[model samples]
Target: MSHSSSDDEDTDISESEISEYEDKKYGELRNGVQNVKTSNENGTFICPYCPRKRKQDYLYKELLQHASGVGQSSSKKRKARDKANHLALVKYLEKDLMDVDVPAKDSKPTDESDPSVNSHEQFVWPWIGIVVNIPTRRTVDGRCFGESGSRLRDEYRSRGFNPVRVNGLWNHRGHSGTALVEFSKDWQGLQNALEFERAYELDHHGKKDWFANSEQKSGLYGWVARADDYKMNNIYGEHLQTMGDVQTISELIEEEARRQDKLVSNLTNIIEVKNQHLKEIEMRCHETTHKMDLVMMEKDKLVEAYNAATKKIQSTAMDMLKKISIDHEKLKLELESQKNELELRKIELENREAHNESERNRLEQEIRENAMKNTSLHMATLEHKKADENVMKLAEDQRRQKEQLHAKILHLQKQLDMKQELELEIQRLKGSLNVLKYMENDDDGADVLKKVDSLQKDLRDKEESLEDLGELNQTLITKERLSNDELQEARQALINGVKKLSSLGNIRLKRMGELDTRPFFEAIKKRHKQKEVEDRVLEMCSLWEEHLTNPDWHPFKVIMAEGKEKEIIDDDDEKLKKLKKEWGEGPYKAVVQALLEINEYNPSGRYVTTIVWNYKEGRRATLKEGVQLLLNQWKKMKKVSS
Candidate 1:
């Protein structure tokens, strides 16, 4: 709870009235009271809990005084609700500015603690008034406003103001129209000098009447401001901290005087605002009084109008009452006559109703008898119709079945004739085919299955025999000795290629050399002469020399026994690995070297063209086929856990 208005007023704060303030407490200052926000529009410390008001600009000490005074107030003051808030404010200031001590409200502390009554007010015994807009020119002497101080004093005296000192200061370099009039400690001259402000608005112009050139229509050419808008001078307009005081005797005194004068001027402005507000309220009150008088006059006229209307209504009502009485008597006579006629009509209606009821009962009895006869007749006709429909439906069903049976017999006969024709065609084809001539009768699809099984079994046997024969040839070739020189050269080349391949890790690749099985196998199988194989390979190398280096030509791929990718398998490399296992590494290396040279010579085969070939089927190998081979190998691996 706090007192929050546009400003901190000089009036007493009660607990109830202060509690009505906005919820801005010290704890809810800028960020939080813990970190006090000590800035206001004037770049000075402020009370966050108070809605800022003019003349409330405080030096840190003054604000501390306000907080501590309210926070530690006695019970009679009834400022209890704001005790915690003011206490927080004190803490906020202490924690931030590190100042000490606060004076009680309306009480005087030592001159040092109270900056208003500090050295300036105690030492400086003169009241200053600033006057402007005096006549001065470059032609005039350097004297203040080109006039002597005594002459200026004489002018102000004639105007009802006396000053102890009058000094004119330079505006720039030449004489200025401004002078500082210092009055004695007595209030007489000070009050008169201030009257320039009261009589007419005095400002920088310093003229009673302001003018376009001389400045007409302003009090003392607008210089009537009390010591430059000061009425009763107090503290300076801002904190003494901003005055650049060095705590020296003269500077401190001056700082204190400026601050005191500022306070006085601020307080005067506050009073003026309040006075203006009071005047406005009075004006509003007067307007309201006048409006009330108008309303009272209108009320009198409305009362007179109402009385006239009442008399007119009374006369019209009396005439209406007489007419109503005459009509009432006439209506009573007509009513009595009508009642006699109505009794006769009622007797006549009762006799007619009794006759009609008897006639209605007789007609209803006839209707019931006729309805029973009609119901019996309807049921008999329905039964007859149902029996006739049943007979027709049964006859129709028999006719439909007879027609269906005849059509079925015709379809069966046609099927039998087609079967006979098919048998004749089969006999003719069987007679013409030599393979079917030995076939037996009573055969079904099982016989066809039997023939296919026999063929597959024979093919499997051939493949197994071929594999075995190849192994036998490899063993025989390995048993024979190789020419030492040729063998050494081939082995050396193979060693170099392997060394290069091993040096480049999996991440980097450089491929060389090729392996061909046909020439090598032919030498082993047909000639069993290593020399023939080597010599023929040499001829093949020279033959395809141009094709090997051509980039556009790719007849063979660079393959290895194993690769990092799952599907990257070379059939030739697989065969070479097998051959090494069989005929030994020496012979396999020789064959691979000879093929590599031949492949190098082939221009069209310069670019790698991979194949999954069985020499009879030298089709280029596809990624799909390689992937399938990898999948098959994966499926065949033993299900073993490591």
Candidate 2:
């Protein structure tokens, strides 16, 4: 039923059939959006009524889409106020962004007499403020301008504006509502004064951070525009002329400077436009040169055709002379015909020369025009070089501003990410809280309590090991990057082992293993390139690497043969059978080096194998046990020697 009502409401509010209130609302929004778009360099917009997370940082188009959707939505949950805001947004988007056919209002002409453009004098720099729709200044004997400037100053000063002088105007009988205020020369005072431009009366009363929203309902509302007091200069000059005022001297000089600055700015704009036109003229000159080349090619073709025609006419004349010699009576008539043809040819040649003369005159004119354009282009290029320095200065300023904005955005993004992470953690804690409540209310609460108690006892009993584990964790954290790399390497090795269909972990053989040479013999049967012992070792290692599958084969007995260390089969009397039985039929092999270490200071010396095998399983205590065993044997030997 709610959905049906929402749909009905959506159908009822046709876009073209909005009421007076909505039309006024939409008009105000359109104006606001236009002003904002003019001022805003970045095309980022946001829904004003949305929650903080959803409201910030939307591109212009995305905001438009959102506005369109929410304005015309059939959702039952949308509030009437929210719908009004979104509809205003839709109106702004369509009229200002989509249609884009509306003409802008005419801007006021530049006021050359405004003193702020060039004045740098202390306490005399001009800054104007306009206040409108204010209540009349009331006195004991009714409305009057008795110290009205002081009252206005105190009133505005309480609300973040600090105007130095305020002139409250009056009607014929009483003080009026209009006041012209003067502000300080500093930029901050101007900024504070400008902030009052769009503020209504109620906005000044309480809404300190309010926007110029037309929907705000208030009685006797006032708004103002910040404007330059150009006529103030003329008023001062007139006062100086009549009343012997000394302030007009500096004021006139400042006004003249402002006028000069405006003139220079206009001249610079004209020069920039002239430079653009010169470049266009240069392009036209290039096009004219191309056309001249085509005309020359046409002239060359015409000259060739004329030469061919001349040869034909000469041959015809030769033939006619021969005919004249053959018949005397016919000769006269043929001669007249030949003379008529020559006259026609001469007239055609004269017409061609006249056309050539006209063409040459036109080409010469174009050449002169092109030369003039080249001179103008050179002058424009020199002027453009001057403009480039100013443009470069502006570009540098914009670049610095862009970098500041980028840093601010990065800081904001980091804060946003941190806020999101904290929110997620809070949600997780809430979920944990719910789980704890469920556990407390569960029917198996007693069993859970017992399990907790048993776990606590176990924790206490294993406190020392827990401390050791924590130390190890701290070690890993200290060298986290290196530890992570070593872990990944181990994981990759295990994956490689699995891919070869071998043991995932190194398996310890009960006895030392020997090379099962039967497969090796079969493999190297067709090979007979064993020249040096080095060659034999290379061939053996290659064969071992290529054919070996399991990774547990760490055969490392290497000895000197033919001036190179060579692997040999150790077939000692007691271990031969055991070596043959252990790794005889394994599908794995490897070639590695091993050596024995003997301690010279020991009472009873024994050689220990120094073999390095990659072990993934964490059985580290075994190394300590082996060392302890060695120490005990050394002590026994020492006791016997004593």
Candidate 3:
């Protein structure tokens, strides 16, 4: 029924506008992501909603809250409110974590009837309090913050922090500002609260006693978690039956165990995942290292190409700028030339206007002279000729002359108008030229700006690439360090294993087991030169010992006719010094001389046995010398007979 209702609700709320909202949200997210991407383009600003920005926000929230007021809850109501908020936050987090589109079910409600009565109670008892002394002195000697415990208490209270104080002042009447603190009950709660509040700064007087130093700063510090246990026992009379039922404790223990197991499992999983991630990181490091080699090669090539490109671009830009400068200079020169031409044209036009005015004055003077002479002559002729004929001819002639003058005036006016129009056209052309020059300058400026933009963009791209490479290098270094540590550990382990194996081999060798001489000889032969002296020594010893052991291996020998033992001896300063140092000049010297004489011989004839004996052997024996002594002594001695 719940599922059907949920489906119905979902159907009712399935609106198309929600999809648009989602799309808009997605677009915003994409835009944010894009902003976070290394902005190679110049003048681009990062969006405020970037992941990096979000991370900073999150960090500020977490750290600031931890550093400030959220940690200062004391009253029950405040604590409960805080816990509820915490629970709501936890639920929000869980909801985000789960992402399951389902509503949670409500569990059964417990009793809501009475406020005072306990449904089940084992016992009731009055709150007991204990007063403990915490001195303001250091016990090592007498150094402290120079404050009495009471003064410290007052300071704490003034600071709006409450601290438990002992009744009356500790250490009797000498101490002032002592306070008595009252407690309702004794438990871990009071201790926790006290410890939390005890660390603040305090203002007081007097030095601490250093002679009775304790681990705690208060020289005579002591505390107990509970002081009511003995009283409860006394009241209960040794063995009163508890009424709360054992199941409660059992359930608590079980719940605690389950929680612990879950914690352990989670921790183990976390460790395993972390280890796996470490391994993956190692593998990635290897891959990256390999790729880095290739990347380095490619990077080198790219750097070469980029450098070459940059060099070319720089050369080109310099060339372009040089051309632009030249062009600008040329444009300025052209503008100056145009200004000079315009000035010259204006001067020429002024001169032309002055000449035209002078010509007009000359023409006016000729016309005035002609009119005066004609007027005088016309009056004299008017009286002399036939009046009708003369008057008609004179009128006709006057009309024709007036018409000609009018035509000349009209022609001059048209010439003046044409000159004005020509001047106006010249001015328009000059203005057009100026406009063209400005447009050319604007084009040049725009081109230079574009080049600057391009350069800036390239620089930004290179910088971003460099930063990425740097971050990658750092990550690589971290991975390399981890690998190197692991490898070093492994190498040490291998070395230890080798040492153990060598130790085992030494133990085996020390057990007096026979060695395979054939293999030993083969190894020596293969590894050492045939003419090596050690090989010759071994061969000679083996041959001599074999020959001496065989009963049938007797050889001819010569001796001093009446042979008593005769030993040859030689000495040098070194031997004398050694003998002098090793033994005192007494009977010990004679024994040493005899031994030295025996050791210093080279025998010529031999059919010998050798016997080595300790000096403690009581037999009257002659210690022979040289190879002959060695063989003869050995021949004379038997293992059982000796």
TM-score of each: 0.18, 0.18, 0.15
State the lDDT of candidate 1 residue by residue for 503-597, as single tens digits. Answer: 22222122343535454445454544666766765564444333344455333454445663222224355545675676555556554554454
Report lDDT (Cα) of residue 288, candidate 3: 51
Q: Clash number for model 2?
A: 0
Model 3, which residues run further than 4 Å from truth?
Answer: 1-187, 190-254, 295-642
Candidate 3 local lDDT, residue 481: 100
Clashes in candidate 3: how many? 19
lDDT of 2 by residue, 1-642 (tens): 011123444343433444443555566665553232423456666565464454565666677778768876878777554566577666666444532121123422224355533233222224455554555556777755533667878877887777766766555556655566666433444455545544443356322322356465433232222112222443322222221112232464455568568878999998789667656655665665566567657756865786577568656755765564455435445555655655565455445533577886865665566556555655655565566556556656755775686567556555544444344334343333333333553589887566556555554545544454456456658799787788656544533333343233442111112333444443344344545544554566455434222334323356999999865544442333342454342212222111111111111222221221235452222333333444565687799999
Residue 570, model 1, lDDT: 40
Candidate 2 regions exceeding 4 Å error are: 1-83, 86-277, 297-301, 314-318, 324-642
TM-score of 1: 0.18
List the candidate numbers ranked by TM-score, top first.
1, 2, 3
Number of backbone collisions per candidate: 47, 0, 19
Task: Looking at model 2, report the run of 10 residues with the lowest lDDT sum.
Answer: 594-603
**Against the hidden true structure, what lDDT does model 3 obtain?**
0.39
Per-residue lDDT tens digits for candidate 3, residues 1-642, read: 011122432222223343343334334333432122233433222222222443332332242233223324454444333333233332222222222122123321112243422223211111112223343444455443234547655754575445444333333233322223322222222333333223321211112222135454442222221222223343222111110112222333354468568878999998789667656655655565566467557746865775576568556755755675566557556555655655565455445533576786765664565555445445534443345455456655755665576567556544444443344333333333333333333548776555555555554555555455456457769999999899656544433333333222111111011122343344445546878846744763465345333445233233455666543332333443453454334422443332332233212222231222223442212322122333443565555476
